[model samples]
Target chain A: MTDNGPCPLQRDAPGQVLSLWWASTGQETAMTTSGRTGDEQAARAERLPQRPVRPLHLQAGALALVLLGGTLGTAAREGLTLVVPEVGGFPIALSCINLVGALLLGVLLESLARRGPDTGPRRSLRLLLGTGLMGGFTSYSALSLATQQLLADGTVGRALAFALLSVVLGVLFAFAGVLLASRRRAGGAR
Target chain B: MSVAVFILLSLAGGVGAVARFVLDGLVRSRVSSAMPWGTILINISGSLLLGLVTGMLGAQLLTPELQLVLGAGFLGGYTTSSTASVETVRLLQQRRMVLALGNLLGTLVVGSAAATLGLVLGAAL
Candidate 1:
């Protein structure tokens, strides 16, 4: 038996050692192939050997955490809407809420990835905060509806601007968050 | 909002989030694509539903409070901008500029169209 291959002990081992090994080797293979093709990452990821399916109980636990986190996040968003005050009929509150959520999600995901692979506490936090809280806090439906309303109201220019700005700025903000986290890690390392 | 309505809204939001999570997972498992198709589908569908609700509100078929709960609370949680934005950024980081731009623009364009269709259909009803 090759000692380098995944073993039972390694599979059950605690902490980031197993994940690091998988990331360095397994993910490198996927990344390299996908990097070459650019569009085949997901297909390659699926074709690659996968980890064992998680137990049902663990999956349920994740769902429960998402539910709890989503509730709190939605409430927070609602509370903010009550006080955020719109500007001249523009959906400023909605835009700010979405931008902030996107920024925070970028920060949270990058920091967690830096900390370690997605497992144990890290996985829990990702589902709860990243998927659940931030997901709930931001509203794409509202953005779409607001744009539609603007167009219907004959302000086609404003409608187009709103839609474009929201999508473009949102992506930019997320990138900024990723840079912020990575820089923090670099500073800490130094 | 009243305390009761607030609680209901929050609960609805939780349900919507769970629905999004489940639907996304189901789609992801079935389809392997570099683009975040799951989020795109979710956002478009949620936008459609919200638009329908809005039309209903305009037609006086749904109460304002009910619209608040369903539109702002449920559909709001169901459709996520943050994930969509982050996924686009990730694509850009991977140097898939075309896919990144596609994901960003595609979602907005298709989602807006879906919302408009829903609104028209709902108003016609």
Candidate 2:
């Protein structure tokens, strides 16, 4: 995410990704105005130098939005866990939740970037949905605990496989989401 | 779970998310690495705490409902898998294979280690 003012950290590396959940929002402004090709814009947005640095500041409104979105996201995750029976204690529900969250976050961020600069409503939605909702919905700690439990239960193979597969699949799913959104943008432009 | 407990769990999740936001901001403000140190720290810490909570639950130090509120709600909200995954993909897209792999594998390995340590500590307690 981008910040409100120029952040020295934002200017650290040329293509460094900006903002985690708690950081400032709105750094991907270059892609929309560069007049570059769509693919280039997308690539640059993901890789090249970002827009001006913005200092990370605490915003009550953004925090509140994140809080609200997080409540909904946590409720949804809890509800799903209640219904999705564990498959032989493999935590299929958690894997599903994390994978789905990764994909949706990819889609949301890409679509929002393509739509416009990360400011105003775009920033708000990113904070609410991307940082708050998706961040709350997916869990790495639970995955770690589950893996540890499996190892403790003497299921070494299952433990390793579960962890490896989930991480690998999560990256793939996120990439798939980016492609899905990019394709849609292209189709719409044509 | 009772409706009150459920609502409390959800609110706890909200608070946890806010906590994550604040901590990440604090770390990001100080660190200027290409890697997302903020998220990496948050995940490791949250995993450790979750492991401790799980051990405590096993030892009957905490009730099941309280466990749910803290484990599934608080830690789950605080430690984010999506951000980690998306950040990895973004790094890979940029062809920073070393950093990408480091971010991916480092989190998994360190986070698991932290969880193990927490479990041990909790059980000892």
Candidate 3:
């Protein structure tokens, strides 16, 4: 990539985009209240972090990796669903897919970040794992729909249990992944 | 799921991920907010579509293969829980309690609501 330290554009920086918007809006309000004119406001905006202008090649490479990874992850999920399917109106297959994917993602990100500065190979790897594989593997939408369906069917207890478990397991697994990676790193260093 | 179905699911998933990436970027470019509207929109719409597909399949208005392709494959790739969870953690770290809570609660509540609406509509059809 362009070597801007792990390429924020490539990383799952959705939160970054949101926060940026909020910061800019707040800044604009401050500027307006301070009697700064349009020119002054523009000058202030110039100092903020401008969006990275990624080159065509890097963009294309990332896109290709994402597509490849997404295909694999989705197919894998489908395979699992085939074997497990839903039982008792509960989507055991989806739950397993999401939880496992979340754990893997945590490990992937932790290991990748610890490897070194996010540059050529590292960036590509992150794209393949974070954006492509995990992105495809763990689905928020399906989980929501499945939970909602249970709710619709008056299975309130089951819906709540599934939802709570997903969130709790997701966070805990991610933490475990980070811990495991750190331990590996420490051992390697020693 | 058959071999052909698996292949189709893979293709659909690739398309779905690309669609998510494109739509997220488009929203980010067009709108500025602390709320992460891009992801929110993506998750909500994906949930609705998945719910509809699930409903249709359940009602036998659609086939199982279609459900595998659309609901499990496309929607699965399109909406992401890992990223959402990580974002929530990041917000918490930044001490943006309101926004963090909003992101978490909003996604759950609104996404579930959208799915419910979709299910109702699909069942009605």
Candidate 4:
């Protein structure tokens, strides 16, 4: 690679260097492109694996998927809230939603992990379910608000119980989901 | 909520989730922390906004429709307990006890404070 003489563009932006590499090497280079900003570039370089830049169309498609999933998730949450009355200011509905969302998220992740790092459909599915649906369904703000109200109403015990229960149950349900997925996988294998 | 309100709520939720994704991605891309600063920031900010909305609603400065759109829809989607819980557990699993405790306790402490502050500001207005 050094025999090609000083690749001045190498020190230039990785994106620019990539274009130059294409011009010179006439083949796709393995070197990764840097992010648009310097800080992002450093962070990206540290965590992300070297890969070709994604096309704009693909990114837009993923965004659309996430939006659709989010809408459904939020609608479900609101619908539940409307039906479930808060007893003594305890947000039973919100806690149930969070636990269920965590469980589903765990299941999604476990199943996706089996397929490994993905492109196209699998990646899109991950974003739609994990980032959009579950994120929308399980709300931190509502939990915070409920807890705040409980405290304000002088029910510190209930508030503390609600907070601790939400965190503990959310994690436990997620772990249970993962275990369920793994058990199913094992059964399928047998 | 009416059908129209539900529709608006759904649309707002979509926007909020997209905002969360974009904002979280932006923060994660900039910060190199194992503590999940992105989720923590998003949760705290969302809590503050929700508090403001609640205060405004209590003051009767805003309609229920607006509250549904901005509060139950947008903030509800933007702030995620599931991610926070999962991330904290992940940190614990990785043996980063300090980070795990920080994420769990920090989010709750800051979120509550921010919400209360927003409520006060909203009520003042």
**Pick by DockQ: which candidate is best?**
2
lDDT tens digits, residue span A1-190, model 1 = 1223335464334324423433443233221421356457666667655666543223666677678778888888888888888786688989999999999999999988986777655666677888889998898999999999899999999899999999999998998999988887766655
Q: Give the TM-score of candidate 3.
A: 0.75
Better of 1 and 4 by DockQ: 1
Residue A116 error, candidate 4, Å: 1.1
**Number of backbone collisions per candidate:** 0, 10, 0, 0
Candidate 4: regions farther than 4 A off: A1-58, A186-190
* Model 4 per-residue lDDT tens digits across residues A7-70: 5565344435324524352233333344366786577666545666554223555567568778
Give the true-structure RMSD of model 4. Answer: 11.6
Between candidates 1 and 4, which one is better according to lDDT?
1
TM-score winner between candidates 2 and 3:
2
What C-alpha lDDT does candidate 4 achieve relative to the native structure?
Answer: 0.78
lDDT of 1 by residue, B28-91 (tens): 8889999999999999999999999998888888998999999888998889999999999999
Q: Model 3 Cα displacement at B22 (Å)?
A: 2.3
- Please list the residue runs of candidate 1 whose C-alpha ends up more than 4 Å from where it truly belongs after superposition: A1-58
Ordered from best to worst DockQ, the candidate numbers read: 2, 1, 4, 3
How do all models score by TM-score? 0.82, 0.82, 0.75, 0.80
CA error at residue B119 for candidate 1, angstroms: 1.0
Q: Give the winner by DockQ: 2 or 3.
A: 2
